[model samples]
Target: MESVRVPLGERSYDILIGSGTLKDIGRHLKGTAFWRDSSARTAIVSNPTVYKLYGDTVYESMAEAGFEPVKVIVPDGEEYKTLLWAEHILGKLLSAKLDRSSFIVALGGGVIGDMAGFAASTYMRGIRFVQAPTTLLAQVDSSVGGKTGVNHPLGKNMIGAFWQPSLVWIDTATLGTLPKKEFIAGMAEVIKYGIIRDSEFFEFIGKNKKDILNLNSKALTRIIKRSCEIKAEVVSKDERESGLRAILNCGHTVGHAIETVTGYTRYLHGEAVAIGMHMEAHFADMPQKEVARIKRLIESYGLSTGLPKDIDEGALMAAMEIDKKALRGELRFVLPETIGSVKVLPVKKDRVLKALKRGG
Candidate 1:
């Protein structure tokens, strides 16, 4: 087992990563300051499909640790990640009469984690929550950062809060049950960490792509640990995305636009991100060799490298205008400087439109 600490002063928490750690969730929760509070309570927010898969084990773990958790299940899908679902979950918490001392345990993928965390942040002002991310995308990205929100019709993650989790429990064994495309989607974020900050890690991913695809325990554990560590380090320095954290949204600017234009029903978040990274790299005039390397890496993992031919370029540009990172009227993109470095540049609308029109 390995752990990374997100040092956010009072909001600090440990992200525990390992195989088969789900069974130990109870013990781990007990070690936190939240557990020390005698009035503490925990409610798990998950989807029906995921709840059927591993909810019993998680519930038992919490029960053994003295938390009589409320099992609040939400409908599954990116389309369902809306204020409506958040309100529904909040209704459950209210029905249970949970207090600030209580924390919500998000036990599914990014959708559940985002909604549950959002609900926690808004319910009766604010409360803590635990992120038990079940998907690779959530485990490596969403679960570590405090950014929580549901998708808006105009933009993705537009309505959210910077509510940190009390603890991030990552059990890699859960990946064993993840679908093939979903696993590949998660790789986009893993590669994003490499592109935005760690060139060596990018090369490492290329070298071990086979092992990672095959779910080799050592490879999966190593990548997830490294990804979390990178995110933890970034979040620690800029918990509220005041400055350095914007780089974390390397492909998200274009990626979220794609997701929104497609109505959140098309590509998975990471798949859209894979394409977004390639698109942004193209727009930034990155080296051909470097861009090719990134594309090869993405395609090799069975992910897309560009937007679908049918997507409306005009709509994509429109969606991006409403991006959370956009300041004033400019669209700021986190463009690659090299294999391991990036800069946030506010490019003109015409340039981005041309890039989208170029299409992959």
Candidate 2:
């Protein structure tokens, strides 16, 4: 297994990545001092679709380790990630008679992890939570980082907290169950890591797109581990995103806007991000050749670089204006300086609108 540490003082945690790690979670967590007591309860929060498939196995394994496993099954989809859904899970924790000593096991994709992590962060003023990310998007991106939140009707993840998980467990084997479109969506964020931090990694992805899409074990393992490493290094320096962590949002500003405009139904998170990256690249100051290269690379992966068919440029711009990264009414974007280098730039409304049109 490849491991990366997110250093956040006392809140720091380790991220473990490899195939079949899920089966060993019991061993990995066995005999911990925190669970030495007999009263510690562990709650596994997931959606129905995921829980029906893998929850019993996980629950049985953890139960063998002596921790009472409780299940909180949430409804699937981005629409379910709301304060109401979080409250429902929180109510479950309350009904379970959980205390600060108890643990939360987020055992699904990004939505499950985010809602569960948020519940853990707020329940009893905060408790330990473990991330068992099942999707490629969750395993390589959201699962490792501590950022947790639900979307508001106004925007995506507009309401969230910087609550880190105690540990992140990624089982690459889980990717086998993911649909082709979902797998492709994840490649968007994986590609983002390379675009913003490692030119060589970017080149590698450009070369191995086929193997990656095919779920080749070696290629998937390398991408997930490397992506986690980059995220860990960044979060270690800026856990609260006061500075360096902004680089992680390379395509998120416009991406989030796209999600909101489409009512979170048109595209998956990474698909929206893929389109966002293309538009951001157009706004970049790089030479036309570099811009074309980035576009081609994204397209080669079967990702979309064009705006949604029915989205209006004006509405998209309006959403971007209220993005969290905006400061004093000026929009800030993480734009590429080169394949491996990115910096946050404050862009004007007119310029952003122009880029949106170019993307359209």
Clashing pairs in 2: none
Model 2 clash count equals 0
Candidate 2 error regions (>4 Å): 31-38
Q: After superposing candidate 1, which stretches have Cα over 4 Å from the reference? A: 31-34, 38-40, 152-155, 327-329, 348-350
lDDT of 1 by residue, 1-360 (tens): 888999989998988888888888977777666676734457889999899999999999988988878899999888799999999999989998898788888999999999999999999899888899999999999988799999888656789999999889889989999999999999999999999989999999999988999899889989999999999998899888889999999988889888878877788889999999999988786788998999998888989897778899988888888888889999899999898999999898888888789895
lDDT of each: 0.89, 0.87
lDDT of 2: 0.87
Error (Å) of candidate 2 at residue 342 is 0.6
lDDT score at residue 249, model 1, on the 0-100 scale: 92
RMSD of each: 2.1, 1.8
Q: For model 2, give the RMSD to the true fold.
A: 1.8
Could you give me the TM-score of model 1 versus the true structure?
A: 0.93
